[model samples]
Target: MNKAPIVFLIGFMGSGKTHLAKHVSGILTGKVIEMDSEIEKKYGAKIKDIFSEKGESYFRELEREVLYEIIATNIHSTAPVLISTGGGTPCFYDNMEVMSGAGTTLYLRPSNIVLLRRLEKEKEERPLIRNKTRDEILEYIKQKVNEREKYYLKADIVFNPVNPDIGNLAQLVKEIIYSSFPYFG
Candidate 1:
């Protein structure tokens, strides 16, 4: 029997893709394929280290490969996993094309101020963003968000990071999936 297609969560840093992906995965009986974690495993280092040592250009190559692999691997995977990608995944390379082609792409949006706060707390863990100041981070987010919005807008669904409420975020995910495409259930 043919399995359902995969789902993708595309957004900026601190936009909450990982958190939401986990929720939807549970509700959908799908696995969560985290692109960043896959890269770290291949290189045997943290994502921050990959950026620091190999640089963004190199990391992008790995990102593309992982995205491709995830889709190919899950083409026959029942339950269909949710993919949480890095902030820049859509901006660079052909990742956006691959993601949108693979399955549904959802955008998880939070306010810019909220993102600033979230990024501030974890900049160290995200080396590409560690050197940016508050204003710079905000500006960068604005610029990147603007650029990626075109791709993200192609998603099958969009949700506010706060509206569904984090506590029930998982439930919301399932509800969205079931309601939007009940046949998948």
Candidate 2:
């Protein structure tokens, strides 16, 4: 059995990190943990409600705690683990540092257009960008992508994950898995 190699997936919201984690977890032979879902379960409320009620600070605090806890799990587990971090996970705290130190970090790195398209369809589910116009979504993505680029670039591996063939992403990740682990270079 392949031991858990500590894979941290990072990207903007709707960039498919969680979806890709699901796929990768299936084929890559690892347990999966999603930071957002973990937080929601812990708080017994949706992340949107948490943000609205307690403000982003509280959510950030919870996110940090969860990410650290997940990192600890990976450190102790013997099997390869796939972790999907929140969109802003790396931007705040020393998450990038923790991730880089503990595991291989991969950025889903979807294009703004693709991200906007995916986000538009799911806006209702995500209160942060709900009811936003297409133009507004585009602008928001641009600003977010810009602000988060520095944090995102800290990933050991970055790839454009959008495509006509989603399965290709799994192959790409597998290639990375075989050729090199993050921070090994």
Candidate 3:
């Protein structure tokens, strides 16, 4: 029997990692492990609350733990596994290394303009940019993405588009998977 492959999606917030994972899951036929949701479930608090109460340092630590646990579970699972990770996951600690070592990592990079629009509407729910002004939010995204690009670029594959059209995204993802792992085809 062939063991399942762990597919990890990494990108900035509002880059549509979760949505992409959901779409890919339909094609791949596996459980989608959303890191943020898992963290909330395991810690009994939303990520914003965790960051507020315990600070980002604590949240990062918890994220690391949860990532490891998910990887362990994926190792034992018979079905293919897709992991939608938080924006900052690859930038923290040795997460990028761990993810690359364990599975195929895809970086879904959207333009700064796209990210600003998405994040602005949902900033209140996001701890890091919740307090920033519109201009600040845009600037922050530009700077943060520049800083994190190095880590994100280490992924096995990157879907860098100014604005990716969702209509054919699933088929595109399938192509990526087959190209990356020919045996999967």
Candidate 4:
């Protein structure tokens, strides 16, 4: 079997990166590293709280630190490693370059309508759109997605699922990795 030691999942908020990472890890028997969760655990504060207290720049710095830490510790791991990055992770610093160089980078591109619907349900949990009205949130999603697409499109693999099936998606990723590094087996 081909083993991709690390796989980074990048996408907009509410794009199901964490969920897909968990599913992929379960299938591959790998470790799942949620960057936002890691930051929250390390700093002892929710992400929204971090954004409010320390600001976006501080939070982005923390994100960069956590990303490097994860790579440094897991680069040589024997088992697969699935990393679910924050929406803006790739857009900051040289994160896109670092993650792409480290291992496979997968971009999860869901439709804007889908993102809007998902974000609406969990707006309060998201610091960026927490205070925005429904209409404002839609506009924000459109604007942010357009701005972030450049960074996100730099990923090695882009998986745009019309209706994402976690199981199938995980298997597809495995197949892609297997194809990419046939000598790994």
Q: Order the numbered candidates by TM-score, best leading.
A: 4, 3, 2, 1
How well is each residue in 72-152 modelled by candidate 3, as lDDT tens digits?
A: 878766556779999999999999999988888989998998899999999999999999999999999999999999999
Top model number, TM-score: 4
Q: Say which prediction, candidate 2 or candidate 3, comes out ahead on lDDT.
A: 3
Q: Give the TM-score (vs. native) of candidate 3.
A: 0.91
Model 1 pairs whose backbones collide: none
lDDT tens digits, residue span 72-122, model 4:
999887766779999999999999999988888999999999999999999
TM for every model, in the order presented, reads 0.88, 0.90, 0.91, 0.93
Model 2 C-alpha lDDT per residue in residues 1-185, reported as the tens digit of each score? 32337878899999898887777766765577888999999879999899878988889999999888887767866556778898999999898888888878888888999999899989988767887899999999999899999999999888885474657787677667645533222
Give the candidate order by descending lDDT: 4, 3, 2, 1
Superior by TM-score: candidate 1 or candidate 4: 4
Q: Highest lDDT among the candidates is held by which one?
A: 4
Q: After best superposition, candidate 2 residue 77: deviation in angstroms?
A: 2.2
Each prediction's Cα RMSD?
2.4, 3.5, 2.3, 2.4
Pick out the ten consecutive residues of candidate 1 with the lowest summed lDDT.
Answer: 175-184
Name the regions of candidate 4 deviating beyond 4 angstroms.
1-4, 181-185
lDDT, candidate 4, equals: 0.88
lDDT of 1 at 69: 79
